[model samples]
Target: MNQNIFENISDLITSGAFLEAEQAAVDLLEEIESKDDGSQAFVIFKFNVAGFLVDIGHALSNRGYALKAVEIFESLEPRIEGVIDPHQYFYNRANAKCHIVEQVSTFDLTFSSIETLVEAKNEYWKSIKEARKVNEEFPEQYVNLANCLKRQFRLSEALWYYDSIREMAPEIPQSWINRSEALLMLNTVSNSYSGKMLHEISSGYNQASRSKFLPPDYAAYYGEQAERFRQGISENDHAETKKEFEELSEYRKYCCRSSLTLSEHGLYCSCAGAARDNLTIPLAATTVGGAFVPQMEAVLNRLKSEFSMARRCYFEYTEAEIEIDLIHEECFTDLETNECLGLDFEKLRTAFRLCFGVLDKIGFAICEHHSLKPKSGMVYFQNFWQLDRDNRREKFEEIKTPGLLALYSIATDLNEHKNGEWKNFKRLRNAMEHGFLVIVHPGSVDDIFGAYELSGDVELVELDVFEKMVEQMIQLTRSAIFSFVFHFRQKGLEESVPTGPTVSFQRVNLQM
Candidate 1:
């Protein structure tokens, strides 16, 4: 293998040309097969070919091409095994099997013990030794070996791999970032890797992992998404959530009766791919410029129905402007999770859109005045409460706070009470903002868990965060409005100045 051709193959594989990558692998293999199979060039090409195949397989998996990835991994297994040791191919082969198992409805994965996984994992690194014996300039190979070892509970070995790579990776300085990430994982060795820690990984390691795993498809734009389903309590969101939940629940009864039992074992979904349709959401809100008073009022009414807080709350959505104190300003925060609700909306919007689609195909928009791009009669506010993946509504029943919704109830101080009227919106927003968008699907014990998260984001969060936020925001709003009214009345400005909802709607032209 000429050094130039070897480098080209590396570039192509890293660029995600998998078929081309396979052909490149075969080219290297054929050259070695016909002449000098044990030459220096043969050794270099075999190592390059095997490494490329594995990288391509990883790329395929990241792109959601699971079967394709499995095929790539499987195809490379036999060829690479012959050139390298059996240990080298173990990790990719195991990962391929794991992905396949993950997709199956029933595969009896318990039969595949962790010990077997570890053995395979260990072999994968052992092959790296053979590859390095041929040519040792490859820094990423060491990092890859470390990551594979780390996945199988081999923290020390993984760290050794990363540390070695750190020493060897001067050509690729990003390895320090990788080193930073691998170090962080050590902290995560004993603890759960979710919530704040998950954010750290996505922001640091996951982001770095993307560059390593799929250089061509590294996600460039990401931030936290707000889960303001409590805004569902707002008139617009409330009306939307209520109407949507009832309609979906009613439809659920019919769908439940329509279950189709599989010929093999379990019952097939009665939904004629309603789940598929739900994933492809469509937005229907009309965007016009300025005077989006009606939209705000509409949302406010629904929020009023859903939320009651202790402090004056402000709900902020970005348009051309940042702060528009028309309906209300939400000083939204998950006191429990300590998540801020005032992050950028664009990143969070995608998450809401995803969660909305998960909720029976509803789409959402946070229109500023009439600045919604196109005009339409209906604006489909996204419903995070939609149940599909695993009967999330049933989970909601299990996690609901029965007494908090009452006219007069004091449940904020209670640690066990399940109410996230405040925190859910903020935390969900935070999670979505950061690229972990699928949490809004309501397959968990709490739908509001999508908001601020509860127990654990991977589990659940404190109900107090939600309850207190709601309680405080409501009290604040009432007080703020009362002060506004008294001052206006005292100044005699009430007669001449505009009175009523601070934000009102009017027909306005959309700039975009």
Candidate 2:
């Protein structure tokens, strides 16, 4: 029973049923204790069960239940001494710890302790050391170690490990991702030196008297010898100034050229292109204000595609109506027979409703992408408009810019008036989505009709008017998205100050 129990548990875990395997392990342990009380068989069975449980722990960790997996692994720590391989046990434990740290960093709002990060870093280091004893060439150990170093702000050390992985396994996409991420961090740190000149002047040291300090003109007189000591502190062409500006420009290019790709799951880079089979759109790796550029691109692309499809459907419906009109006016024997000729008003209605639905979707997408606050899952586009209004009003008060204030005024008017354009649009969308009966009254002119919801008193105008309304809404949404993207881009650039000085200084003792 004990021998077969392990096999059964392994099968469950292999099939991605972690919960069932955990329950089975518990049931098997209880059965063994009840039947084989204090017997040698019970001890051997428990040890074997403990080893199987370790595998389950690792599986749970991989499946994103890192905290639970850590708990399971910790419980088996006492029994793991002789039951499992030291390298395997330590490696799994280390990976689980790293996952927990990552989860906490990303999602846990309550955890802000530095000690937790340090603990995770130590565990990763310990795991790497243990794994190396058995297999020095293990790639996972190096990768995990690199991530650990990066999390601890050890950028240079992290780069070393990432470079090592790239050299060893050049085909791995993660190696390139990690290398690029480290380079970005290093660039940010090196370029963040805004008040360097101010600081140098404030230090109260005379530039000419300072050792090895050559003013701007000193380079022309001393020729090559002066070129080496010339400082960039002056306005003119000093050798040191040329070197500084060139280095800064190079760093800026590196930062700007960093690109990310959007897939179904999340943001990736060109390095992951080979691994992904889904649609991928490449975008600059900059943040649009607080919003990410890749995410913004994905939302905008989806909105544009939906809008285009709706426009095509509208054109098709209009074309069908025009053909029916021509047939009745010129080809048909009697005008009355046009009605009996079997025009599919239902299909046209369906197409019109679809256009409305797409317009509503665009509004919701715009709100979701730009809103600073989390949206309510219950209400769709209503919440977005409300939040956007609030944000615009707040910004207007702070900056009092005329253009922003005008936008704020529009939002205010929309919110204040019950029969506002945005409100009418929202109510119409709600009716259509909730299965309210939509009636279309045919107009005297061909290809024109009045559409309205059964529950609402509002009467929509002719087909052309409706089309114009939809077109206006589509244009408004498009403009809003572009404006938000531009606003965020400017904000992000403004806030992105360098973290440290590009130049380094050394202290020397001077005796005069």
Candidate 1: residue 283 lDDT (0-100)? 12
- Backbone clashes (count) for model 1: 69
lDDT of 1: 0.35
**Residue-pair clashes per candidate, as listed?**
69, 2
Query: How big is the positional error of residue 314 in model 2, measured in Å on the Cα after superposition?
Result: 2.9
What TM-score does each of the candidates earn? 0.29, 0.29
List the RMSD of every prediction in angstroms: 24.6, 27.4
Model 2 over residues 350-426: C-alpha lDDT tens digits?
44455444434544544454443334443233233342354553532343222222122223213324223344555
Candidate 2 Cα errors over 4 Å, as ranges: 1-291, 318-371, 374-392, 395-422, 436-464, 495-512
Residue 472 lDDT in model 2? 38
CA lDDT of each prediction against the hidden true structure: 0.35, 0.42
Weakest 10 consecutive residues, lDDT, candidate 2? Answer: 259-268
